[model samples]
Target: MNQINNLVRHTRLLEIVGDLIRVRALGVAFGDLAMIENIDGDQSLAKVVNLDRDIVSLQVFAGGKGLSTDAKVIFLGRALDVVYSDNILGRIFRGSGEAIDGGPELPTDPRIPVGGPTVNPVMRVMPSRMIETKVPMIDLFNCLVESQKIPIFSVAGEPFNQLLARIGFQANADVVVFGGMGLIFDDYHFFRTAFENHGVFHRTVMFVNQASDPLVERMLVPDMALAVAEKMAVEGKKRVLVLLTDMTAYADAMKELGVAQELIPAVRGYMGDLYTQLASRYEKACDFKGAGSVTILSVTTMPGDDVTHPVPDNTGYITEGQFYLHNGFIDPFGSLSRLKQHVVGKATREDHSQIMNAMIRFYSGAVEAQKKQAMAFELSPFDEKLLKFGRLFKERFMDIDVSLPVIEALDLCWLTLSECFDPKELLMKQNLIDKYFPKSAHSEAEEGETVAQVA
Candidate 1:
């Protein structure tokens, strides 16, 4: 009971105007944590809405459900803080930063405010270093550069969750923080075991808001996860990766709140401030002035695979790049990381850019070849070569199971190119071909008369 009292305190009431409860107080800060208490025979959850001139407003989290005008509101007198320490690694927490796995409560520390301002532009270092996940499709082509904000735009039932898990397992980061909003029970369990099984849980912290949890709580997970991530990066933890899944849920929660508040609706029944809300989170990925960086890789699932969905449409404007996950794979043609150019050849090998471009160009041709074949069009000899290259590309490079470092993936690209066509047909610089082309291609060329014959 003492703990409960410490968490909730009384202050002089400034005014109670309609649903708004205003109070004069001290030690109340913006985003400072507060909890609802049953007073005047009321039972409901409440959220902190406004803190001004040491006065705080407690907006009922449960929509003032079962709460009378005289209900007691308690201020914790401290900002919302997440438990941050080495002990947080390998732990699963609810949206409120409470342990849901029946583990001991995290030790208290100085409260850290959530949803802090974005890093200043002058302080942000230009992103150059690559954060390798060793996923062939991602590392080889759509590289995850440091401090880049990219989204995995996928549809439901696709392997976006698995892909995120794989990246979390393979990322060479000092720490990984995962925030799941409105995830189902299966996805929550899958992330838990995937980290545990892969031995990466030792450096991972997860804040999950499941679909069964209170809807209001779903909106808090990102702020919680990003706050911890910012702290870790500021402490010089290099390569801090923040993974958020299903931000669409978070947006929907915002829309629900807007409707409850009777605000005017924006496009698609979303709030007018949807873009600002998303940018606040996405812009949190920054390379600090003197500290380590925070890289954000989030999943934004499209409704009915519609790219024009409000969530993804607004996301596309704010994020640096996107990985399009389709039909259980990262679509090579559709997925893109705009920051890849910053690191592809400069941070990686000289052939990194060349190979990525050539492979995708060839794959695009293969797509056209596939269309031609489907239509029963007469295939040119070159078109036939494209068909063969496409099939091999899908089998060797596009498949999610094929994992390799960026360099090794580039090597496989050369091998694939060599196996399908002659050096001249590849349209690559003669110098690069002489340097990186597989020896098998030269030997096969000695036996074969032409590129067409090889295909």
Candidate 2:
């Protein structure tokens, strides 16, 4: 180890394999960022991935291509840090915190370190508030509670990214931090354009690692997004929503690096610490004691639509719940929000809990009715009603394009139920039915009139 401006520098490389390098250097800490300058004057960045006594192993950000054995490596004695300020909002940055939006260069003041520990348990408050996303299925059924960490589990070819962008713009929060890993140019452009066109770009910050970028940057996107979100929630007293797309990519990046470092592979070639790495990011969602909150809603694409896949399997144990996305709709039966109990009837309308339950119960019955009809069983009059209700349910509430506030969604739930079943058939509390059930205007005469009008 040689000292240049009090920073540790090593001028020899013992090994260079697939973007990984080993050097005999002292005083190097894990996760420390170092500058790797080759003799050709081309410089790149690397991070200390492993440290064993006097030997340090780093993963070069720009890859170890055409590199000599004696490149100068300078350890910065600090972990990866991202620039943070009010100007960071509404800006687009790469996973490495570099501005790629052709905007003016931002000052490097108040750079905050990424990949920090989770918030203290004592400093976290119980999540009791709701994040209204104006999506009927999410807002009315699976309420997105503040400070809740959840994922939208889906597979490829689904509109999960579009759904994510909708929530990013429509969600009720003081700020939105979006982290996109392994996105193509089209998907990246879609998110930016969606936020801009929907008038949320002013308060949205995006950290993107495109498919063509270095694999190491994919793992940095979440850490950068979460770090900025935590800073805003704790220090700026702003409610922040962090949206990460395709956590599978992040996990795959870890597996690739693990293989490069010759570490023992866990299940499916992933590193053994996949769960810990995921929990560290998801746990960033917390409501500060006296400050604002950080709520995380990420997308985890299951390979081959297998929930048993290690990424989603581990995530299921770590997150509060998941919104299962399939066939371009948020599957009501497959989706859940475990933290919704804290806010269902408390922060929302009194009829929320009742409406949610009755709708789902009836929908389940409707599905069974369809199955019975398909198998050539005799259909009862009630089964006919269920069939009608099922169609209206999918058309009105389940569609991803349908956007309604929580209150309006609750009212619509009542209308949809009334169109098919009598108030007594709802099986809800009598008092709730008395207060919210449709009156004579939605009764037989009006129902006949509605049919006539449609006819």
Strongest candidate by TM-score = 2
| Tens-digit lDDT string for candidate 1 (105-128) | 766654467777898799899999
TM-score, cand. 1: 0.89
* Backbone clash total, candidate 2: 0
Native-vs-model 1 lDDT? 0.82
Local accuracy by lDDT, each model? 0.82, 0.92
Residue-level lDDT of model 2, residues 241-301, one tens digit each, is: 9999999999999999999888999999999999999999999999999999999999999
The per-candidate count of clashes, in order, stands at: 4, 0
User: Which candidate comes out best when scored by lDDT?
Assistant: 2
Clashes of 1: 4
